[model samples]
Target: MANRIHPTAVIGDGVELGDNNDIGPYAVIVGPTVIGSDNWIGPHCVIGTPASDRGAPHPAAWHDAPVGDPEQDGFGVRIGDGNRIREFFSVHQGTKRPTTIGSNGYFLRSAHVAHDCRIGDGVTLGSNVVVGGHSEVWSLANLGLGVVVHQHSRIGPGAMVGMGAAVTREVPPFTISRGVPARVTGMNVVGLSRRGVSPEAIAELEPYVIQGAGELPELPAELAKLLTEWAREGHRGEH
Candidate 1:
C-alpha cells in the first residue's frame, strides 16, 4: 500500500497522497493537495502550485517548498482517484476555493488547469488544452488538443470540442462544438453512441440541446441527473 515516489520527486509539506500512486521523477507535488490512489503522475508535472491570480501570494516561486504555508497555499487542490496526469501538466491552486478534479481524468501533456476549476470524472483534456479559472468541465467531456476554454465557462457533460478551438461560450451536453467562440455544429452522436445512449434517447434529447431550451428527455439515469442539474440552472440560450 506504499506510494512509489521517485527519489528526485519533491513532495512538499501538507501533501496527502494515497496508496499505489506512481509519482515520476522530478514531479513536484506541493500541498494542501490531496491526491487519491492509483494515479500515474508523469515526470515534471507541477501540481498544487500557487494561483497565477494577480491577487494571490507568490511565495512558492522562491521558497524551497511551493506551498510554503499550508494555509497560504493559494487555497487547496483535490484530485480524485484513477487519473493519468501526463508530463508537464500543471494544475494551479484555487484563488477562492479548492480546484477540484473528479475521478478517472486523463490530462495529456502540457495541459494547464487554472485556478478554481471543477473538472468532472472521465474528462479527457488533450495536449496543451488550457482551461481558464473557475471553469467547469462536466463529466465525459472531451476537449481536443490546444483547445482554450474561456474563464468561468462550462463545458457540459458528454460535449466534444474540436482541436485548436477557442471556446469563449458554454458548450451544451452531447454536442460537437467547434470554431472560434465555439458553436454547436451538431449533436455528438458518435460520443453518445459510445456512451450507450440509444437512438431513441438521442432523438429525444436532440431538441433540448439544439434549441437550447425546454425540458430534458427521459434519458439514462446518469445522463438525466447531470443534464437535469445543468438545465435547472437555466443554462439555455447561453451556449
Candidate 2:
C-alpha cells in the first residue's frame, strides 16, 4: 500500500519513509531521518530537529561532534515500524548519534523525546511524558501521564513509572516506581504476569528488591543474568 502523506505536511529532503505510513496534516518531518512502515504520525508533530544542546560554547560546536553527519550534523532521527505518535509529539535528533525509537511505540499527545534517547520496543509514553537527553528506556516499559525522566537514566524492561513521577535514577527491570523522586515501590508482578512470566520466577526475584540487601538470593538463570547486568550498568552511574 502507498504511504498517505497529507499535502500540508512538510517532508524534508533526504527523508526516508517506508510503505503504508500515514503522516497527518501539518506534521513536519525533516531530513536525514528514516521512518519505517505502518507509522501513524499525528498532526503538528515535529521530528528530526537538531539537539537542544545550548550549553555548547559556540553554535558550530555541534558540527564537530564525534558521531552523526558533518554536513547535516545533529539532524537524524531513526524510527522503527508500527508506532503511534499522537498529536503535538516532538522528537529531536542526536548530538553524536541518531535518537532512535524502536517498533510498536505508543507516544501519547504532547509527549517529548529529547536528543539521543534510545526507546525500546513496545514502550508507552503517556500524555505529556518527557524523556530527557541520552536516556534509555528498555522494552515494554510504561511511563504514565506527565512522567519526567532525567537525562542519562535507564528505565528497565517491563518497568512502570506511575503518573507524574519524577525519575532521577535508574529503574530496575520489572519494577514499579512512583513519587517525586521515583522510589522503587515494589516488583512489577502484574506487568510480569501479563508478559507470561511464571509466578515462581517472580517470587525468586522479589528478594532482590528488598532495601539494603547486601547479597542476592539464588535465582533463575535468566533472572540472575538480568540482575547481574543491571548491577553492572547501575555501577557505571548511568542514572
Candidate 3:
C-alpha cells in the first residue's frame, strides 16, 4: 500500500520511507533516513535532523560539518517497522554512524532521542523523556514521563525507569530504578511476569536484585552471565 503522507508534511531529499506509513501534518522527515513500514509519525515530529553538536569544533573538523549525502556519508536515522512516534517527538541523525531504533517502539509526545542513540525493540519512552546522545536502550525497557538518561549510558532489557527520574548509570535487566540519581530499587517483578518470565527465573535473579548496584554474588548460570556482562560493560565506563 502507498504511504499516506499529509499534504503539509515535508519530506526532504534522500529520505527512504517504506509502504503503509502515515505521516501526519507538518511532520518533517529529512533524508539520509530510512523509515520502515506501518509507522505512525505524528504532527510536528522531526526525524533525521543533523546532530545538535554539528557546530562544535573538533580536531578532525568533521564534527562540525553538515550532513551532505546521508547514504554516502553513513550518517542518518534508521527506524524499523511499526513504531508510533507521537507529536513533537524529535530524533536526530547520527554524527558518524546511523542512529537506530528497532521495531515496535513507542515514543510518546515530546520525547527527544539525541544523535547516535540505539533504541531496541518494544521500548517505550514516555512523554518528555530525553535520551542523550549515544545511549543504548535495550529491548522492552520502559522509561516513564520526564525521565532523563545520561549520554553513553545503557538501559538493560526489561528495565523500568520511574517517572521524573534522572538516570546517570547503567540499569540492569528486569530492574526498577528511581530517584534523582536513579538507584536500583528492586527487581521488576511485574515487568518480568508480564514478559512471561517464569517464577523460577525470577527467583534465580532475586539475590542479585537484593544486593543492589554493588558487587553481585554468584548466581545461576543465566543470571550470573547477564550480571557478569553488565559488570564488564560497566568497567568500560559505559555507564
Q: Pick the candidate with the highest lDDT.
A: 1
1-239 per-residue lDDT for model 3 (tens digits)? 99999999988876889999999999988766789999999999988776889584222112233436665765788999999999999988887678999999999999999998999889999999999999989878899999999999889877899999999978877788999999888789897676566777787665554444344544445445555665566532222
Q: Which pairs of residues clash in candidate 1, taking residues 3 or more apart in a chain or in different chains?
A: none
**Local error of candidate 2 at 20, Å?**
0.7
Clashing pairs in 3: none
lDDT of 1 by residue, 10-63 (tens): 888778998999999999887778999999999999998888867767665324
lDDT of each: 0.87, 0.82, 0.81
Rank ordering of all candidates by TM-score, starting from the highest: 1, 2, 3
Q: After TM-score superposition, what is the CA distance of residue 157 in candidate 1 from its true location, in Å?
A: 0.6
Q: What is candidate 1's CA lDDT for residue 124?
A: 99
List TM-score per model, in order.
0.92, 0.83, 0.83
Question: In TM-score terms, which candidate is top?
Answer: 1
Ten contiguous residues minimizing lDDT sum, candidate 1: 61-70
Any runs in candidate 2 off by more than 4 Å, and if so which?
A: 55-75, 209-239
CA error at residue 67 for candidate 1, angstroms: 7.5
Residues 1-239, model 2: lDDT tens digits: 89999999988765789999999999988756799999999999988766787774223222232334634664468999999999999998777678999999999999999988999889999999999999999878999999999999889877899999999978877789999999888889887776566787677666554342445555546555656766676532212
